[model samples]
Target chain A: MKVLALDTSNRPLSVSVLNYDKVLATTTITTQRKHAAYAMQTIEDLVKVAKLKPSDLDRVVVAQGPGSYTGLRVAVTIGKVLSDTLKIDLVGISSLLALSLNVEKEGQLVAPTFDARNDILFTGLYRITSNGPKSVLPDQHISFEEWLKQLDQFDESIVFVGEDVANFKARLQAHFGTNFKSVVGIDNLPQAARIGIYGEQQRPVSDIDTFVPDYLRLTQAESDWQKLHPGEGHESYVEQV
Target chain B: MKNENSLILSFETSCDETSVAVIKNGKEILSNIVATQIKSHQRFGGVVPEVASRHHIEQITICLNDALQKAGVTYSDLTGVAITYGPGLVGSLLVGITAAKVVAWAHQLPLIPVNHIAGHIYATNFDHPIEFPALALVVSGGHTELVWMPKEGEFKIIGETRDDAAGETYDKIGRVLGINYPAGPQVDQMAHLGHDTFAFPRAMEKNDNFDFSFSGLKSAFINTVHHADQINATLDKNDLATSFQQAVIDVLVSKAMRALDKYPAKEFILAGGVAANRGLRERLDQELEKRDVEFVKAPLKLCGDNAAMIGAAAEMLQRHGAKADMSLNANPGLEFEWAENEEE
Candidate 1:
């Protein structure tokens, strides 16, 4: 099966064309907010290098959010349009899971994180299982201090992955000591190939129109509205007004 | 691709409107689809950047398909792709940029980056081509500026607002009157119903320079409303709206007339969101008519925000070989730089 996958949920924008489990062509650009400018050209070039047209793709996979709001929207928009336009199966994967699955260590706990500003991180804990990295903790947006406290309760060594890990490296090392091992390199960046592999294991979205990026946190405006109207349903300010 | 046969597909998401349009030779708009998120933002009293970005992503492809279908064209027929890259919300602009980049790359076409404010000004060309030495009054929610165009594709910003844009001031004052988000049209309607009872202060009115200041006017309007509220005195909403609108129009017209005297252009353009105002449009028409200058305003439907104007701007850019490579990125505060004169 020919699969085209994209990951722009974080700083690094990755695009890959794959045949089944093996990767045919992949490009990873480690630039901030360049997703909109570079993702399509990379995807088109990758597909062309692999000698396939957009219509020949069997499935489309993309990294669903909980990271940069604009970055995630870039990839998700392309993914949805390509999949829906070509009438192909569309699959969405957690961005943090894609970063964690990049770790090759077996039985190692992977805690992939993306900086969420204000000392918070969009992160989740995963354990490398026989099949792949299984989620030990679901994706969430929490402060680094809180997430570190949760990691302290774990008994095994944790492998920190993702481009933003360096931002909290000193604190991570202080907390985990010898048990914490850092995986820092180009390979640690979120890869579309990983997204494609994991997407195969998951079910495709039944309705493409209803699918949206999984922005874990509400926008500032939405939050402000919520604070003003306590315990109100999430019907949006426009509807309520 | 050039000339009358050239087909440009444009994307515009610099604000709450997600628009896509297919234009031929820059002037003929075959299809212009604008999926507005005004309702989604009305409750928040303004556009929420995140919501605008999300909606742009969801509607971009649909708008793209509709534009192509309505134009009776296909990707193969597209000569180039165009998009508004900046001077608005970064998040909102990125969606259109990404979508346009992808479509252009997939089809192996040149990507033309357009300025959003320029697009607003260029909307005047939808039915009629702009004459050379054109003077434009660009007024929108985010901008209030006077641009001088010596020739086609040449723009120079001679004057602009230092504080709040005219449309922004309208919305802010509209909130005081308990109106919905995007108070420009609502306030204009109310202004038409009542007379200007209170003579509001026209900020920077007597200034020698063309630069404007509306923050003082906004403050005065807010303070008056609050003072009235404190005394439990009822205020006429129409009169307040009329008084505020008159103040804004007074300053805008004064600055524009000053520019006209300095530049002496043959053509005058009323562009952007506030260009739809009944008072401003009539005032410019009457004012420009005295000078024997052709007065052109963006059609009411195209005045808000749409991609058709972007398509028109792209056609102009393509003539100058202003193609954006893969390194093109969205600039939230993008400025229009005329490269043609520099090369000359």
Candidate 2:
């Protein structure tokens, strides 16, 4: 199956085209720019370099949420529209899981993180296996101090990956000591080629019309509303209004 | 793939509405579908940018599919894709821009970038062919402007609001009256049932320039209501509505008349969300009938943000060789370029 995969869930943007497991062409830009400005252009260029038309693709895989809210929408919106218009399958891969693909050691614990401001981080825990990275703990948005407390329970050597790990490197070293491992430079960035490979094993969304990025946290407005009206059903504030 | 009949697929998510439309030659709407988030924003008493963005991403593709299916057209039949790329919530605008760019790339169709305010002015194309040297009074929740167009594709801002927009003023005062969000239509309805007893101040009514200021009027209205509450006296809500509406209309109409006299346009257009006001529409129609200028009020249904109007504006823009590539990004503060040799 021919596939296109994209990730814009952070400052870095990646686009890749593959034929099954072989990546035909891929481009990853680490510099910060408006992802919305160059995401589709990069996809178009990569597809041409891969010598394929948009209609020739069989599926689209996108890195969906737990990062910048606007950045996640750029990729998800593009993925949803391309799949819908071309009548192809659409698969959403967890962004944190995709980052964990950088770890090659078997049975090693991998923690992928993104800074969520106010000392909060969007992070998750995954374990590497021969097949791929498997989620051990789900992705979540929590403060750095709280996340460190959760990691204290695990005794395995933990490898921290992601561009944002640099922000808390000292604190991580102080806590994990000899058990802490970190990957910097290129390996820390997300690779769309890895996303395409993992997505091939996942099921396509049953309803493309209602697909949305998994933003691990509620919007500030919704959180405030919930606090004001406690003990109420947590149904959609949109539907209730 | 250029179709014999020009068919443009357009997207508009500049504000709270996610609208998609297929236009035939820009004049006839094949199918326009709008999914509004007014109910969701009503709880917040105003639009929350984050909530609006969330709603837009969910509704965009749904509207696109419905629009194409209702129009009975496929990607192969489209000549181009157009989208609103400016003067709106950045998060909301990016959703439409990203979707439109993908459609254009997948179908190898030309991509057209349109300004949201231009889309409002072009809504009048459905009513009549806008004559050359047309003058437009554009008013909405976010904007109030007097735009002058010398020809089909040329635009210049002659005047605009110095403070709060006319619709924004209505909403602020409406909140004081305990009305729901977007109280323009309801406030307009109440104005017809009562006399103008409060005699609200009409700011910038006699100013030489076409610029408007509604902040003073908003402050005056708030002060009157708070004073009434302190004195243990009740002022009639209907009378307050009438007084506020009259003050707004007087300033808008007087400034519009002044602009028409200065520019001497062949046609006059009343455009944007506030254009749907019955009082403003009737007053402009009566006032314009006395002059040689032709009056054009946007169709009530098309006054709010919609893709049909964006497609209409894109047709004119395309004829003038306007196109954008995937590098286009939303400009949240975009405004009409001052007309050539007309900039102050």
Candidate 3:
């Protein structure tokens, strides 16, 4: 089975070609906002290198997001179109969960942290055993100290894996000291290869009709519109209990 | 299956509506469902992107199901997925992108990334097969441009909005006249009610190039309203509307005629949300007829943003053997692929 995976859920954009269960080629570009401009060419180059035509793929995978709203959309749109164009099934892996896949640990928790701005971090408390995380943490934006406090309650050494973790490292060391660790060097960032790895262990939704992006924050425009038109209440949110 | 007509499931959530459509053979729209957020944005006087994105999720499922039922097809019958990738609200674009990607993966289909403006332009394909080396004028809420296309799917922006877009000017004028936020439809309606009794400024009417600027005219209208209120002078709203609409129509028509006269193409395509303007369409038809140039315009009902248009554009990509993998991403500002290494 050929699976093409991409991670554009954060500031950086990553794409990879995976066959069966092995990674053949991976390209991750970390920049402020060049994902949309750079992603297609990179994918084309990867396809050329992999000797794959658009129709040879079996499934398209994307790192769905709880971070960078625009980045998330970039990954999702490309994945949808590629899978659709190639006649393949699509799999969506949580970008945060995908971040955890890069850290190889026997008994450590994979804690992925993304900068959410406004003094908040979009974080997930994860643990990677032989099995994936026993349970992925809630995807939410909370203060870094507040998040660390929540982590202190858990009874395990945590390995944080994400590029944004570097931004809060000093404070993180102050909190957990030797109790905390992170993905070494560039492995600290999200990679499409990792998203592919996570997608491998998960199941795709039975119907694409039920899927949606997990944008943790309401855009400022929506909030303003709500304020301007308070006359009628908003339609019910789509999330199911 | 290779010979089977490609089935494209397309989604458009760029603004104010959540739309889904299944197009078979590109020209035939099998099922198209759109959940309008007009009532939701009625109080805001304008679209709120955040609200639009949220609404898209709530509406995408019903739209998808309706498209499937209307098309008489299942995921098993699909060939590829298509979606409007950008040049719209960033938030609004994501909802469609997310759903389309997942379904594409579930069905193991190719993904086609569509430029929304291109989709609007391609909507003409439903009614007619366009020839090469054509000129397309894309006028909408967020954009206004004269794009030269030497062949299908290749676009070159020869001229564009220098300041406020034509649609934005219409909306702002509508606001001054106490009309709805998007003044295009209202202006079109009002233009029919009265004659152009007053002369409004047509900025750059003498310019040889196709570039447009509506800021000066819009400011003039707003200033007129404010000045009238201060001086206690009563201004006829309908006359003002007619006069303003006439000015816009004149400039647009004049520019289009100039483009037709030079670097002539066999056909002229009008596209984007603002293309629904009755005044503009009628004028284009009358003007283009004089030149004996073939004209293609999207159906009025399909003029605004929608998934069916995206499906139409996606069909061309499929014909070119373009395919997207799971990593296909949403591009808020993805320029229309005009030529190699050039983006509009």
Candidate 4:
């Protein structure tokens, strides 16, 4: 099965066409939130390098986010359209989990960090179990100090993943010293290929009829209402098809 | 191929709505599907960028299929793809751009880049074929600008809002009155019932150019309401809405007329969601007639945010040989440099 992968969930834009077990072509570009304009160009260049036509693709996959709002939206939006036009399945995968999936070390704990601004990180603790990378902690907004406290329990070497790690590298190194291993990920900050593999495993059907972005934050309006009204329960929307 | 027409699929996810449309020959709209996040944002009183983007992805496919099916055309039949490239919420723009890009690549069709403002002006082409070398006033929640298009597809902005747009002021005024968001339409409706007894100051009315400032009027409305509430004075919502809307209309109409006087253009195009204002349309039509200038306003549906306008602009762009080879980009800070001059 052929899979097309794309990610605009951060500063970097990434795309990959994977042939099930093998990668045909993968591309990553790091730019300032220019994903909407550059995303298609990157995809075209990749398609040309792979000697493939857009029609040849079997499925479309994209990184669903806990990352940049603009990046995630563009990636997922394109993913849905491509799958719909090609009459293929569509898949949405978590960007954080995808980052964890790219860790090279086989053992020990891995924590992927995403800068959530206001000095907070969209982060979670993970352990590479025999099955695969398994979550040790749920994704949540935590202060840098709080996260370091969570990581203090493990005496083993821990590998940090994600671009957010760079911003806090000094504090992290100062706290963990040599116990923490610092490494630069693949040139591209985003890993669209993981989205494809995850999509295949999840096998989400393209319901061009019904699909939406998975933004973890409440809309500004919702927040405004909540603040203005004070103590109103969050209204749940029964998404209509 | 000796084809007389080109089928263009257009997408607009620039704001609260995720819209898709199929335009044939620029003017004929086979289908226009809009999945509005209105309800989603109703409780919040405004659009949320994150939520808007999320909604765009979910509705992208449904909207695409609905348009194609309504147009009675398959993906293979499309000759080109068009998408709104700017002057909107960047995140929202990304969603539509991404979709348009993939369609362009998948179909191996030429990509057409469309300016949202250009599309709003082109919406006038929906009802009446516009005469060239005309002036267009684009007013919406996000924008308020006077543009001069000397020829087809070339846009130059002349005057614009220094603060809140005409629609933004409407929404702000509406909020103080407990009306739904986008109080522009509701206020317009209410204005018909009440007289302009309260004369809110019109900013920049005496300016030589068509520059506008709705923020002062907005603050004036808010302070008036707050003062009334503080002094325990009764206020009529409808009269207040009407009076406020009238203030905006007077200034808008006057400025539009001023533009007509300075530049003798073939047509006057009213664009953007605010163009749906009945008061503005009627006033402009009457005023433009006095000047003997042709007036073109987009159909009520096209006036608001939709992909059909994008398709319209794209059709003109394609006709002008402006083919985007996957190089089209989102320009959130998009501005018409030529618009700095009333006519160039």
Q: What's the number of clashes in each of the models? A: 0, 0, 34, 6
Native interface contact recovery, all models: 0.41, 0.62, 0.16, 0.69
**Candidate 2 colliding pairs:** none
Residue-level lDDT of model 4, residues B197-263, one tens digit each, is 7788888999888889998898888998999999999888878987898889888888988887877
Best by lDDT: 2
Off by over 4 Å in 2: A230-241, B340-344
Provide the TM-score of the second chain in candidate 4. Answer: 0.96
Ranking by lDDT: 2, 1, 4, 3
- State in Å the error of residue B296, model 2: 0.6
Off by over 4 Å in 4: A31-33, A104-107, A129-131, A145-157, A166-202, A205-214, A219-241, B339-344
Better of 1 and 3 by lDDT: 1
lDDT of 1 by residue, B84-170 (tens): 998889988888887787677656788999989879888988788899898999999999998889898888887889988889998
lDDT tens readout by residue for model 1, A195-227: 897787778988775567899988788688778
How large is the interface RMSD of each prediction? 4.4, 3.1, 7.2, 3.2
Best by TM-score: 2
TM-score of each: 0.88, 0.97, 0.74, 0.89
Count backbone overlaps in model 4. Answer: 6
Q: Kindly report which residue stretches of model 1 are placed more than 4 angstroms away from their true locations once superposed.
A: A1-3, A27-33, A38-60, A84-89, A105-109, A117-119, A143-158, A163-187, A200-206, A230-241, B1-4, B337-344
Error of 3 at B333 (Å): 6.1
